[model samples]
Target: MFDSKHVRVFDEVVRTGSFAAAARNLGYTQPAISQQMKALERSVGSSLFVRVGRGLKLTDAGEVLARHAADILGAISTAQQQMTAIVRLKSGRIRIRAFPSASATLIPSAVASIKNQYPGIRIELSEGEPPDSVEALRRGDCDITLAFTYNTATEQPASDDVFAVPLLDDPLIVLLPVGHPLARRRSVELAQLAEEQWIAGCVRCRSHFVQACAAAGFDPDIGFTTDDNLAVQSLVAAGVGISVMPSMVQSFIRHPKVVSRLVAPAASRTVAAYTLAGNQNVPVTQLMLEALREAAEEMRRGA
Candidate 1:
């Protein structure tokens, strides 16, 4: 018989990006996890993952297994939930993976309430970008994942079998060095800053960067690229370049040298919380929704 434990191990390796991480999460020795994977492959008579330069990636067969494993795990969870609901069970753990902005933006206050209300329940948090977070939810790595990006909520992207609960629409803003020529302007246009140096995001995540520059009718002279938002902001503050970021980036602003301006054309982003479709509801997820509402309200008030 197929072992659910081994399937979970496989999912963990995929979720965290490494066998070491999977071992850490599953509290097993790395070799033990590797052995389990080897046994699983032997049982299935096919290799699920191939060694790729210091990491592992799912083979075609592995991909199929990964996808089905998540569904199976979700179904098992739903079964337990149905049983719990019959008895009115009040508490359980909530696993969450989300973008950096929403990790604390909508999760903290709500989690505080959850802790007070259901002291027995626990929360596990993980940081990830939107696509990865969505994938994690579908793969049963998390109960919910809060993700955000430009126009993602308005124009939901093609995602495999998952559900998203729209949370808020956030505005994007431009960051300028205080001494920038356009700093004192009441509002700025994307076109006006086209000639300025740009700090772009990591690969495969330049959607906003592309849109902002495209609106300007000229691609920006992107000089730096990194996944670290703080590093990008720091570079902007140092006048290395200017960057277009969401309003949430403002929360990290402490440099008097930097000024954040809301793009006059109403450049904004869509933020939302996602969950696996056709799965049982999690009360902690509801708490996160409430927390996000509060965060959105706070942003509006500040605006």
Candidate 2:
């Protein structure tokens, strides 16, 4: 981003279409422009421009250089903006962006832990689906992302750049309305629920449902598809349908008419905490992990 007078000259010459004009633009005089061009050609070992009717044309190398130079300068500007924002944010906030299931099951407990330990640090949280939240992380809008990983047959690997840390294994479960006929059964089988309409969650989250139902020898009868945990819970509460969901989603089932039962084959989602590959904010990340562990303990005790 700094240094290289030749880069400056190369950029100017390309923009103005002639060395003399470039010299006039940069106020460097024609000799200086020629000198910079010589140095640039020698350094890059490429004839970057071709002379044309009283004007200049970029060679392929020169065009490439021009494109890269613009990117480098733009990167420098972006870096300055980032540094300025960081300077303005005296106490850096730990921005936690997450998908809904993680937000419901993991964040509150993790937040409680961060609050207890890093009281001086600001904890900002946002929730959405995985793609948008991952974009937020890529854009420097969030510090961490808590997301779910399905253990089903259809589950694919996560993005390579996302540093996913295993927090817990959340098994999928079937939720039933309290007075429904299945409520009397201690544990429900996928085949048993085959005839029952399933309330679906996220699209990528379809693996759990697909694999579980496949085990029972039939594709599930999906009645409702949604991203909201509460909406699925509400549908089940109304006896509209039963749904298979990660156990962590249990945190959202509040209606008195509904109850969740762990599925028999033990389908699960591997809950993980994600961040950029080389992030230096270890302390808060550690705190968040500890909070997740504590929350896991509380959840295990059903407290």
Candidate 3:
């Protein structure tokens, strides 16, 4: 019979793509991981991996096992959570991951509320971009993931097994230096700034900015590229270049010298929370989701 422990380790190796990484994630030594993989191969009577350049690629048998392993692990996780709920609801952990802005804005309130209500229940958070966070969720690294997409129809999770709940529409806004001529305007149309130099945060954000600009009939003259919103604000404040950013940024931090104006025609991204479809009704997850909805509603009311 195949050992479930060995199968778990094998699954981790496939998810992490390297024995060393799997070792670190699962708290095992590198050599131990290799030994276990060898044992697993002997038991299954097939080599599970092949060397492709400096990286390891899964063999046909490995691919089959990996697919089954994901379902097996997910079932195991669900079972464990259900069992934990029976023992006690107040003493458990929910792992969550989110993109940066939501981490700063929404997570704090939700986490605080959860902690205050159930002090014994622990909530852990990690930050990453939507793609990375979604990948982490798929690998069972996080229970909930907060993500956003400028185009909801195209950017949402394609897998039917993942459940997505729309939280808020984070409108794109223009950020300009305090002394800029456009700073005094209550709303800046995208076409009005067609000739101005632009600052973009990340590839995905830049793509959205470009699309919005294109819709307004101009290609932006991108002068600077960065992924840090604070740096983008600093650049805008210094009169380096104007920026297009989501409204959530203002809730986190704002540069005093930067003036924000709503974009005319109102482009926005939809922020959503994702989880395994099967986990939607899990008690702790439901509680956290409710907290997020409450926080989102408050933000909407205040805006």
lDDT of 3 by residue, 15-87 (tens): 8899999999999999999999999999889999998987899999999999899788788888888688634
Candidate closest to the true structure, highest lDDT = 3
For each candidate, give its TM-score against the true structure: 0.65, 0.62, 0.71
TM-score of 2: 0.62
Better model by lDDT: candidate 1 vs candidate 3: 3
**Model 1, range 1-303, lDDT digits (tens) per residue?**
578789889999989989999999889999999999998898888999988899888899899998898998898889888658533426656787878767656677667766776676678889988677777787789888888756645546436566667767777778898999989987788888878888877554466668657766997888888767778878988989988777775674446678888787886777877777644355556665566567667666766
The CA root-mean-square deviation of candidate 3, after full C-alpha superposition on the true structure, stands at: 16.6
Better of 2 and 3 by TM-score: 3
Model 1: weakest 10-residue lDDT segment is: 83-92
Q: How accurate is candidate 3 locally (lDDT)?
A: 0.88
Against the reference, the lDDT scores of all candidates come to 0.76, 0.74, 0.88
Candidate 3's TM-score reads 0.71
State in Å the error of residue 21, model 1: 58
- Superposed model 1: Cα runs more than 4 Å off: 1-90, 152-161
RMSD (Å) per prediction:
18.5, 10.9, 16.6
